[model samples]
Target: MRVVLSCLLMLLFVPDWMGEPRLPLMGKRAVVRAAPIALDAAHPARSRVGALVWLGGVRLTSPDRAFGGFSALHVARGHRVTLLSDGGNIVQFTLGPDWRPRAIAFGDLPAGPGTGWAKVDRDSESMGVDPRDGSVVAGFENSNMLWRYTPDLRRALGAAAPRAMAGWPGNEGAESFTFLPRAGWGGGAIAIGEQAPWPGGTGRAAFRFTGDPVREPNRGYRFSYIPPARSDPSDMTVLPDGRLIVLNRRFTLPFTFTNTLVVIDRGAIRPGAVVRGREIATLAPPLVHENFEGIAATREGGRTILWLVSDDNQSVLQRSLLLKFRLDAPGTPGSARP
Candidate 1:
């Protein structure tokens, strides 16, 4: 009986990680449940939000500890949405018209800068997908690095830490990124640092990589972006017709975050040029709000759809939300305009 008790105690002390030195949900299937939510809590019928009309939204949650902290989002070919977390975790799923999720999956990045033993080693804050080759490029904050991965994110292709981003603070590096295809610039990428202001601190530091940022960091050049007052740029996407969409977020009292969407003409972006975006929509007050950090654009028929996903930060006081909006005011983004 004494030997049996000793053996049981030894089993309890076994290393939970089994010395694998990895993060959780390593390509493991994760189930996410989303409850329907409306744009206006009190007035559910009010859908008009600036230039956008609410199509649908939901509060997303998961029982797994590896979920949440989704800092970046990508919707590919109008078929699937991929959520990338700051902790190197990923959730991919298809959302139906009814707002239900199908073919859900959860995974972790296979490789990064560090040994994968610490959270900061995988502090990937921004991501962009290459439409030409289906490769994924992720920007890590604490390490201030960029990594290119396979389409499935199951393997790493290349990585680089550009000189243009070398001066950015560890925590404020490359918080927003997007692949800008042939906007008269021969298909490059743009990255925005969250709090790293440009020049005299009037705007955030932005960069345009002339090619694959991970593969060709040398061609990156500096630019300046001035978002709306009191807001920080979170995520960015290029419209189908070459316009730029940027998501800016601000923190409010009593623990909540507000969001604003801005549009910049593609021509406004240039080396050494200080660019600003026109505010088109905002989510605040009675409207559904959270720490929205990710945004994606897709086309459905003749409408350009905007999707937003929130970063919960893995806190009980916060919430993860997925919102869908239809561009109603018209203009670029291809099919969205007449």
Candidate 2:
């Protein structure tokens, strides 16, 4: 009786990030329910948080069991959004005129390394999308691979296993990914490990690929990045101005998650460079709190529009939240390093 009770208690106290791995969800198309949420629950009129202006927010829910666990997000023209879960599931939806979710669809990766029998085989953690052609490059965690896919993400094109990522801790590998528009940086892609510290320093390992990471895995270089204190990088996206918006997440005791947004200047990235961007915004209690793992930015009417998606880990204790914020200027304050 004591052993059984001990096991139950251990399960109850497990951290939010310790949620059980989920299988792929290939559900049918249906509208997802969204509840408009205030940025500041206690003060509904408040909208600003740190350097961001909360434009809108929503708590997304669905009867489908696979509706949550979104880890990476992409917002395209006409507010069409595609969310990729770490479990290799994909959810595509459009925002109605009123910002409600519509035309929702779910899909599982057509093919991945190994038999899709185990979660580790398909643990896709981050992705980068080509702006011109809509092609996608997915970064798998446990396998430490980069896989390219069609615009619809229904078919695999090619895949590669970069040598630098071979040593990244399974769960912490390739959590931050983006395609660099900066020609000076090879105009290829950048991927940063979530928590694997560099061999010689405290920074995490980051890599720059000269072309399709899957096609030219050996044509680039590696660097290091110092994220916010005690935070792990989850996702990142490039801006029209050649800057990067990185989302870092933290989980605390008693099941709490907070996110920090950092912006790195285009000039700071280079071969073997150790970069730490400036802090832009902080998302936490009193204002908001969730496991915000994905961040995407785009230019709209000359203003930078930022979108964040949370990974609920498919736990009833948490929520799948989608938020929008406006960053008035691209040039942010001083850098942060610790």
Candidate 3:
């Protein structure tokens, strides 16, 4: 009886003497904000829509094997959505009635080393398509080279064509690009590069080039002070009002988030003038994902709708999230475009 009582007393008091206390079984919950007005509407052609679409919280082995790391996407002339994988492979998928990828076709990357220290080894990052000719211009990450492919995409299949542009200064790896029209310069393309090991910190830079791949002076300027700290400007799109919207990734140790969307005023930027920018909105991370890299904007009805996508980097801790948002024009002074 004495032994039994001693053992029971020890079991009851030993936990209290321990340095760490036992944790309670408290359940954790995620908070979901109320749906914005624009996203609440049901019509497919509503003025605007915004929602977060969970893209399989993990990488799909079969799909990724067929597509590689799909980092860039564009809507082609035929309404076909072309996805460019980081492994130098392009996949074309037909948009379904619900605006999802379907009926996929595989394609190839550019040939030959266009620029940088060594031959281009296929680090396709972002791409821009010529609306007039259907040709594709792809930017490689490490090589800092721009490659122009024929509309047929066959010329780039072989390793013989000369590089479209070469020997760009600084570690400006081309990441995002778009086409803009100018009066005397004709229709030119604007390419944006991500942060690299350069003199200045990683910031956004813009370049203007003629449609011809052989043209010299691919004339352009760099916007030195638009992006935020540790921001990896990944993708860009033009707003209806002729402004530029840049999506940036906020990278920190062990965490990546889509924290800011910058808007560059149309009048502030010129052919050679450096312009400042302002952050219009800050996006919330999807559940537990990071590395939001893709951005697209389109006008529905009369409102501007922004779309975003995350790069999972093939890590189990990350996921690809397709999110949408409607731009709410801010009335405050700081919200004004720079």
Candidate 4:
């Protein structure tokens, strides 16, 4: 009887992740329960056309423990999106006519160079898809490394830790990883650190890798990016026209959250140039904000669509939110055209 009691106590203390990882099933579909959420309680389901016109938003919940903690997002080909979580899981789903998630699919990264057991081992904070072949490059924070996967985001092809990104303060590493279409003088992939300040400089450290960082780690150049005051860079997306949209996040006093969207010209991104985005829109209290960590952009007929998602931090006090917006002023030089 004493042996049985001892076994029960051990089971109770066992960490939840001691079980198998929930890897993505290629053809399987999962369901994500969503409740319609308003961008602002006063304005309700809509946002005004300033820099970004609010479309609508939803609070997503799932019985699956693997859900939430979304760190980065990518609008892939078709009407589908690929979301990476801090838990080392990947969720792919198609959007229906009503802007709700449909045909959901989920999986874990098969394996990576870190080989750690916890989610932080795979802590994939950022992702960029290769347009030519649909391949993907994911940046893991705790490990301070990047891994490339096939288009389906299931298999690991290669991995690398760029020499320039050494000692990047662990959890702050690779917060924003993106691909700019013929960007820079010769074009390349870029990764920015969330809390890593530039050496002997201000702002954050951003790196431009000439080729695929996972493929060619030797060709990396460092740059500087200054986000809004009291905020840290979270995620970034390259627009269809080669513009860069960076997402900045802040945790205000009394447990409030704020987010800002800033745009930078494609021409401003040069070696050693300190690039600062033009603040176009802000998301704060009464305007629908959480730990808005992920951002992605797509172009419709005559409009540019933006999607913002929040990380619940897997905490009961927080919530997971997915928001949609449309950029109304693309030709404007700075900020949103009023």
Candidate 5:
């Protein structure tokens, strides 16, 4: 009886062992080495009007507004840009002739079970648009829910579409996702989670979905895990070469830490690929406003440009900062590469 009691106590008191390591905290006073650049003003990367443009650091109107929690910002081939707010709102901003945001429409997302408008409970993180059909897929934070919307968004604008994917274990919040066009391996989709259960760490994952969206079990889908500890990945973009560039934010005191950029080679990720990762760039709090969340890649005058944004949390101390960088490759920038 004593042995049995001891075993129970051990189970209760132990740290709940998981296979993954705990994410490290960025200690206070970490300097942000990257310089801040104005997003609206003309610069080397923004001089051309017809080139692909990347912008960030726009302030939110209110604390409840999704402006600060910009999790996903995507530009389609036709020059259409859609931004998804993690704070339960989807804002569609049309691009003008010069690639700048023209008209903006704001709408609420269908509330799921155990969700609220407040930051403490809201989800709705990353989003992807179907290149072939213009359909939308959104991933919810703190829940294992993946929603799909047909091109008829006007009819089902605020309504939650059918669940296309699920079954993520733990408090794993699906944050960002990008789709690989039908090239090979059946044209798969890649997603990143803020954190996972056994791993007790944050990382990015890649998935291959069966063409069918309605059937049970969703056959032919697989996951490739990339372990980047203490790195809460909020967004991801796939480069032309197939490498994944992940934007990660660290937590030190609930809402403060350095933001990091990581690059994972295409071959390094596969089913059960050991999940190790390397950090290429670290953005200190001072360099960027609080809560840098979204990231995207585009071409500007034959140069590859990387854009990053911050989630201000609607706090006075924070500002939405959009910064741009010129990249030679996924992990080749001097500020980002180790």
Candidate 6:
């Protein structure tokens, strides 16, 4: 009886948002602030050796306490962005001509397959949108589930937990998700684990689910993605020519963040095959880096644009960052990397 009483008291003292998903009461519009930031505070004019050129960046803040923890992002055509928070909230905003955000909206995700109590239960870490119909698919970590929504991201369409994700760690289930737009390879959605080490000493586990994974869960192939040492895959997006660009991140003690952008060939990704990417660029200290957790790519008239967003972890010590770059190379697949 004494042990039971003690456990009950401990639970009472714990924070209400510990593991379950929590959201602010804000309906559609929310007040968010974006402050201009430089690629390198010390040397703002510095540039990397590869084809990527830093365009601009901003640090985002909000009055709402539940505003941070943005882990996944999808950038649409009109400078509009949809961000997924670790707290199970979706924030949508559009950038104006000056790169400042406007028309911000905040809302909670429709309840799905999870405890629905703690943030971890709704810890959505990766997201991708179908190019054909603009349908959105979000990957949740704790439950190892994928939730699909309409183009507007208001209603839940369907969800599923693939059998291939059976042994994935609850905390690191799905952090890298993207949709391949090329029709040559039978375009589909790909999901990869963040910290889930690959079996047989290869690397991280990855799955390519052909067709809608929520409907045809078993129609997919498994593979491996090998990133740089000590780093984990954060987000992935496809290039114009069928290749994939994956973002990796590593954090060191005392608050140091490092980010790497890798480009992989679609031909190298297949069942039982291990795909390794060529390091295209590295973002570290002295060149403006943060806990960048999201990545998206788009093709402009003559160049490829890359957009990245950071997860602030709702900590005062960190800031939500959005960085943009222009890859000055041909849009053909695999040409930008090599």
Give the alpha-carbon lDDT of every model.
Answer: 0.85, 0.84, 0.54, 0.80, 0.54, 0.82
Each candidate's TM vs. the true structure? 0.90, 0.89, 0.66, 0.89, 0.66, 0.89
What is the clash tally of candidate 5? 8
Please rank every candidate by lDDT, starting with the best: 1, 2, 6, 4, 5, 3
Off by over 4 Å in 4: 1-29, 183-185, 331-338
Tens digit of lDDT per residue, candidate 6, span 1-338?
99999767767886453543344434544978889888778876764425577788888888887788889988888889888887677788998769878888888777666645666667888888987788888888878898899888778999998988878988888898987774866877899898876666478999998877778867888998888989999999998777899999999988999998888888898887888898888888777888999998877775789999999998889989988888766454544442
* Candidates 2 and 6 compared by lDDT, better number: 2
Q: Which tens-of-lDDT digit does each residue in 85-132 have in candidate 5?
A: 666555555544433454555555554423353443446677666556
Clashes of each: 0, 0, 0, 4, 8, 7
The candidate 3 region of ten consecutive residues with least summed lDDT is: 24-33
Candidate 1, residues 1-338: lDDT per residue as tens digits?
A: 99999767756875343334455553354788989998998999987788888898998888887789899999876358899998898899998878888899888888988766667678888899987898999998878889999999999998999888888888899899998886465898999999877657559999999877877887967889998989999999987777889999999788767798999988888888899998888888877889999999988887788989999988898888888888864553442221
Candidate 3 lDDT (Cα, 0 to 1) = 0.54
- Where does candidate 6 stray beyond 4 Å? 1-29, 47-49, 330-338
Which wins on lDDT, candidate 1 or candidate 5? 1
Q: State the lDDT at 11 in candidate 3.
A: 70
Residue-level lDDT of model 4, residues 111-150, one tens digit each, is 7755555565668888888765778888888778888899
Residue range with the least summed lDDT across 10 consecutive positions in model 5: 24-33
- Residue 271 C-alpha lDDT in model 6: 83
Model 3 misplaced stretches (Cα beyond 4 Å): 1-68, 76-79, 97-100, 110-120, 151-154, 157-172, 182-186, 196-202, 210-214, 222-225, 286-289, 328-338
Instruction: List per-candidate RMSD values in Å.
Output: 4.6, 6.6, 15.3, 3.6, 12.3, 4.0
Candidate 1 lDDT for residue 272: 88
